[model samples]
Target: MRIRLQPLAASIAVAFAIPAVAQTPLRTLDEVVVEATRERDLPGAAAPTAGELERLRAATSDTASLLREQPGVSLYGAGGVSSLPVIHGLADDRLRIRLDGMDLIASCPNHMNPPLSYVDPSNLKSIKVYAGITPVSVGGDSIGGSIVAETRGPDFAQPGQGLLTKGEVGTYYRSNGDQRGINLSATVASENLSLSYSGALAKADNYKAGGEFKNFTATGRGNELARNEVGSSAYDTRNHTLGFALRGGNHLVELKLGYQDLPYQLYANQRMDMLDNEQKRANLRWLGQFDWGRAEARVYHEAVDHYMNFGMDKQLVYGTAVNGMPMYSRGRTTGVETKAEIDLADSSLLRLGALYQHYTLRDWWPPSGTGGMSPGTFENIADGSRDRAGLFGEWEKRFSPQWTTQLGLRYERVTTDAGDVHGYGNAMGNQLVDAAAFNAREHKKTDNNWDLTALARYAPSQAIDVEFGFAHKTRSPNLYERYTWSTWAMAAVMNNTVGDGNGYVGDPDLKAEKANTLSATFDWHAADRRWELKATPFYTRVTDYIDAVRLTNNAGFNVLRYTNQTARLFGLDLSGRMPLGNTALGQFAARGLVNYTNGKNLDTGDDLYNIMPLNTRLSLTHELGGWNNAVEMVAARAKNKVSDARNEVRTPGYALFNLRTSYTWRNIRVDAGVENLFDKLYYQPTGGTYTGQGTTMGINSIAPGIGVPGMGRTFYAGLNVRF
Candidate 1:
């Protein structure tokens, strides 16, 4: 099946959203092995069977990497387990990311623990991507769309079948970073009760680039980093989850517990590293089916303990703390959600929902010893709190089989506040003056944000479909963006989230961002859906966009403060797939896609930072018996339209190829692949500045104009067995 979502007229098909989707029998994917599977559901990956998840897990441990194949989606390179996702031209806090009905925020100022990083790829059951326009029921408190991720759902044995049991074990290795990992899951069920558990562990050392990217071999510490090595790129992580479910005549109840422990995840673009991070989560949900329709209610909570400082590659500086410039962050989140769906007369449907989330965070650097690090603890963000309460409604009706339309509205009340903060010293580094100025200001803020979506879809014939939509969304600033009070270079530099090798201060009076977008999609396909083509183009204008301005006169990595401005973004996505016919030995197919985006600051007249350049991918796939294979080509154009404000780096165009093969038997499977097959070297356009080593605390300490390099050629293989 070819499921291509449109760009315009958000008919959300969130006019057709997952929250309101019925749980019918989906594809089993048991007959073939695909490198990755596209969801049959429009606009999202709401459903994926075990077979699909297994195939995706065989090659990578990074969960964000799984979505790279999706159109209109890009990534910001970060730690091994954490990568920020970009939809259209917005990223990070600009979009909504949900895990098991819960909205998780990054606790670390450096954004080392993005929401997706908490769930290991091996443990994911399904992930949905709502690319551009979105309906009120599917999203709130965000300007862009949404990505919803969930674990395996509950399962029950048939009556009179006694107890049922099943499990899977898998392992994989990648030669480039010496990466290795193991995963296991077990489940037991009865007619009315089910219990399951899943766990994964992965670790790796620094990886090398295809070719030398620098001249220095020293890390400015007692460490050695070869010219071809990407320093601060190593990581060790483990994750575990347990779930229980109970079902009765017309209702189902479920409880889930999740935990993650990442001892360390070095960063190639930032000075600080995640030395230790721990997350604990619990969620409870209930679903009931009634004559009127369906109803759902859920409550979830999450707590985090995070620590950061210099890693092995970066020179350790400052304080009496054992790990150098020790930073600590503790956060807690609690939320409640409820929704109801009503089936109206004449194929009309109405959805109404309400949600509330409360969050608290404390970020501080304990006094270590000497210089500015002595006297007192540095309070980056003290007693910070952000709360949101939202309500949404949607109306959808299939006027006929060939015509469908949807409309939605959402409103959110966001409030934020913080306690007084202080620096380490009274005079050193202007700690006294800056701290006094910040402490005297009132820190409370509130915003009443609104969102609206209008969409329509038409299927003129079996071979043609058209969809278009318009959306207006709003988002308030996060704690790190509005309450991180500091102007001292050393203190501000440690608070960066964009990894640009710059210091960043926060503004308390920043306004919420509002965006208006226009979009449309045209799809053409064969009657049987074996061959398909899709084109999507979109444009968005934003008011009070959160940009930044220089706070200091220092050149290259100076202090900057968060501010508001006007901006515009436009983009296109093209994709097509067709059967190449069958032969005596195998069946062949072709698939290709292209993505292009341009963003500008209307106020500053400068290009937006980290906008992905034009890129394309093409692949030839073949299948025979239980064997499946593909040869892929990936290329990107030169990134010369730079962001002068951020002093973004420029890179030349480049191309690389890859080979993949997989074989599946009754209960066993094996996968092998070689990436960057020819060992081509390249820099990541969105990977941000390189501050992976040396004495990185001082402004302009690291060399300028360097971007994080892509990984070198790698050989990877995996094996999985199910019983």
Candidate 2:
């Protein structure tokens, strides 16, 4: 049946004008009114407001850094713009991340090009996170949480307005790393159609710590770095996006094309650095609003070509026998999703959705010289593929003014396979034996996973509310965890993902990880909502957790293989904001948050790696008209409960101070800030090991136990112009 969009549009307009508080008659507007669009989401999901984003974007280029203010969120340092976000104690592949409705995958073995790296901070229009208790609508083979980030899109003009145009230009610079960037966006729109474009360029050099942390400056490449500088930490990248949208009454059709070119992104933790990475993406979506509910369908495709080698800071030549080790990876991902919302009644709603994704990858290393690498091409993961198909349904009901509940269930069929692999290793390790063993096994494997979530909310009084939820989540292993075959120190270290300075082998017989989580949030606010306090406590127990088993120990570094075990994690988050009386200078406010998490392996009694210690941040903010200013103090407890299996490094407790201020006037805005004001030297507990410099090709070439140091005092400024 063909539906008329005009009637649907009319019905939706009437529904939008209907007030929930009263039966008021509609009035024709004489002037255009602009408002932000809100997407319907589960109760627990949260997003940063526009004002917050404006403040944070000036200080960072890494998109993952924008989530630092969110409780229970942390970041794993990587390339300059490719920091990996961690929810609670789980990081990387454990979390489901989506950009413009596309599920992107990291093509590199070391994960240098994460999904968030594709979008610049200045280009984000909306970003949200659902921690722990994720609804089936956004949940699949992920156990930690879900994140959705969308770039700015077209905004249609009024029905009678003719040809509207808008544009913005922004630039930023930082002193510590000599980092600089610029971004531009433009849009042309009519009542029924819109065309938009956005682009960004960013680059940085190696950054230095507050003081000298290393004793030598040799880079094994005939180059020398400053004693205080952290080598292999530079990057250069560019991004471009084009978007188009058409609207007819209540129906909307949107298309977006994106491209990224990264010349280089040096890494401080991995043995190899990204020399070049290119990505292309296309997304198409259709959405409609009906009197009963809403419907949406989306299709997306992505392609990536990635290359890695020894950046200038690492050993490039081995006894003049072999050239720099070169690695390459290519990947393609295609996905389709369909969803619908049905209004069962005034107080009840139901949602159903289905999605399918197919992904393929090829990782190889070509021979570079007449030495051990001259024999044949090394096939790390050849013709590897992973596919998933999922179906989910959710129901939500409002029993009364004070009580509401939601329940959701999801089912997914995941299958993975890989072609045979070969290594060019010449008597270095068990390459032939391992490859033969892997080839003899059945590469095809399948898993049927299930997810369930139940949540409820209660409001006892005007000043208090409580939300609680329970979830059972399941996750299958990524290809790197089940396919990589070699155990050679050189090849193994290239496969490490956790930044523990250890090489890891894969386990094909691994079982899917299943996590059972319980959490509750307590929110308290004043009668008028002038002040607020919020606290969340969560606990999770996991069966068949993919940890590692040590295979060889050399010095402090070790070689390990993926294994299954039992694990558990618990955490608490506390945040509050209060307003001080207005003053002549500005309106002052105080806000702060405290986060703590603990993780342990129940089977081995070892602490989980990369777990953040207890940390807190306090800020004093001031605002008056076009002026915004703030001073922040951040502190953390010592990370003493280290992971014993990988010999995790311990970092001492530290405190730092930062100052920021911004002002806007008419069409121009400026932001300036100083971080690490005192220039205190400190180590990042999760920054991984300090194998960023010298002869890092060998597994035990450098001394172990040195954690990557944090950056020194830095001044930054940003400018934006709108027309």
Candidate 3:
């Protein structure tokens, strides 16, 4: 199928370059793979499973809002500006995100940056998403997958004494039947150092309940409340990202700094109130390609500062005479990482990398008179750090023009330390614990890991190709899970209580989660057609699967524990694009993707928590001269599967509609789109749990059912100009 669409895709690429699009063309709808290893596109990647890059200068909000159309990917509704991607069953820290080859970590328990939010969509040269085993160059601690966002490189457009400048400023207002909100952004870029920055501040009155708001009373009679709380449960947010990139000769570099603050945000899925939340990050990367092969390197650091409260359905105040005051706690994290890659000959590639990070956490209170829970503010402050290093190599040999195979291997070492930390009891929630003093403990541990891959490709003819691959990968535990102490505001806790209180004590004893992956794909084209199709099926087995579970000690709150257990994830992906005729009018196209995941917890005999549900995305796009437009429909069946683990909540299913349009002219372009067009109401089919307000001083947030409810419908628009 891919064989037939290559010519049509090529022809459209040519027409898209003329007139309006020539001035500020978005990424090539169909890019070729070069260095992406698995599927390289422009600076990003060429895989169709990925979404197209809409011009950032023409974007309405943060990049996270743009990716909501992807299948199995949804936003965790804190508000418009602060949303997190629930990637196929895996969200939060499970996914590995990189910018210009550098890693960016989220600090907020609520997850502010949410991967796509790190880079101004307008500044992105391209975005490549690898939902499967992905290539070794992009692998690390990634069990669900990887997403690489790249900035525009120098000499990417035209070489030799060239000056290009582009910028945009715009605002949009949305009035759905129940609520209203507005968003805006500004961006600019150039060849020497591309700079694109965007900021959005927005608020919405409480939405009219789609159906009925349930009132859970201590009595058996649950009341059916009217949807009359207009503006009563409203929320607000502020999000921004500033990115700069320098491309010269064979050396290219990029840097991005971003922040997200969502205060007084309302969520229908949880029992608490988000009074304060913040996410801050700085990411840097450098890449150089020599005559031999190429080299890429990067470093990044970020911090999350968070505070919030729950327990009230209406206005309440407890601290400093604040109205509707509620129980509140705070926590923070500072982390850093660095990595490097070097490509050898066409047949051989080598990569070496290391990551070091530190996290200091404190969970405590400041006299909330609302309840007797504030015991003169007892606190637990602990320090945690991670040191990791690895070496990897891959070699691909082409015996013939139609046949090629590649083999890869990686070895790594990791160490962890938790110093000067204590777990609090009674005062926060645990009874066996001390409320008047800080419990202190120390520990250190190390681990060794290995990865392997084998790939084979065959081409009966130039237009048809088939590939099969198998790989083994493993990733170390994150700093938060292995050495977290105090309380997680989102989970509504006051102690590091997962794997066991031992996790907070710093279990340098933890081992890495290992995965064995197998995959097969086919790309076929007709002899004389403008069409193509691609399909892939995969299965992965994880040994010593690391997960967070409630502690058996049952002291004050649930402690987060990390342990390896056997688990499995398997699914299929299929997509195709076709052109009706050779002319510009017949150049319309259609594409779609569907994926699924099913796994078991061999240790406890339960389903994996918060796994992605079966989902699909279908899009119809058209190209006519200087004008391009598209409409996509996305849907996901709810995952009713509930884990047998205690405190686990199930999520609900949801569907959304979206539209995108763009027109290009000489040095000018305009692009606009609307997501969740219908303002539909739905929650994640998989849910998570946090402590309820006044429940205790230990935990804060939780996914209620399967998952939390996503955002209602939204619309975005923007413009771009180049000189």
In TM-score terms, candidate 2 sits at 0.94
TM-score of each: 0.94, 0.94, 0.74
| Residue-by-residue lDDT tens digits, candidate 2, 1-723 | 122211121111100111011111111110011111233111222223345576788899998888777677888878889999988889898998989778888888888888999998888875666664777777789889877777886688887888889998999999999999999999999988899999999999999998998888999989899989999999999999999999998898999999999999999887889999999999999989889888989999999999999998988998877889889999999999998878776577788999999999999999888766767889999999999999999887777777777788999999989999988956658788888899999998899999998877777777776668889999999999989989888888888787777888998888899999998877777765567777778999999999998998666888899999999999998877788979898899988888899999999999998999999999998999988899999888999988888989999999999999998898888999999999989988788888898777788888788888888999999998889
lDDT at residue 460 of model 2 (Cα atoms): 76
Off by over 4 Å in 2: 1-48
Error of 3 at 92 (Å): 2.9
Expressed as tens digits, the lDDT of each residue in 1-723 for candidate 1 is 111111112212221112111111111100011122324333432233345456567767889877776677889989988989888879999989889889999998899999999988877766767775777777898997788777767778888999989898989999999999999989899988999999999999999999999877777677688999999999999999999999888888999999999999999999899999999999999888788878889999999999998899998853334347899999999999999878686776788999999999999999877666877888999999999999999887777667777788999999999999888866877888888898899999999999998877777777776778899999999999999887888888898888888888899999999999888777677765577777778999999999998887655777889999999999898877788989998999988878899999999999998899999889898989988888999899989988777777888788999999889899888999999999888998888888998888777878878889999898999998878
Global lDDT of model 1: 0.82
lDDT against the true structure, each candidate: 0.82, 0.82, 0.49
Model 3, span 445-533: residue lDDT tens: 67787777677666677456566777777777765555544333322332222211112222344678777777776665554334656
Global fold similarity of model 1 (TM-score): 0.94
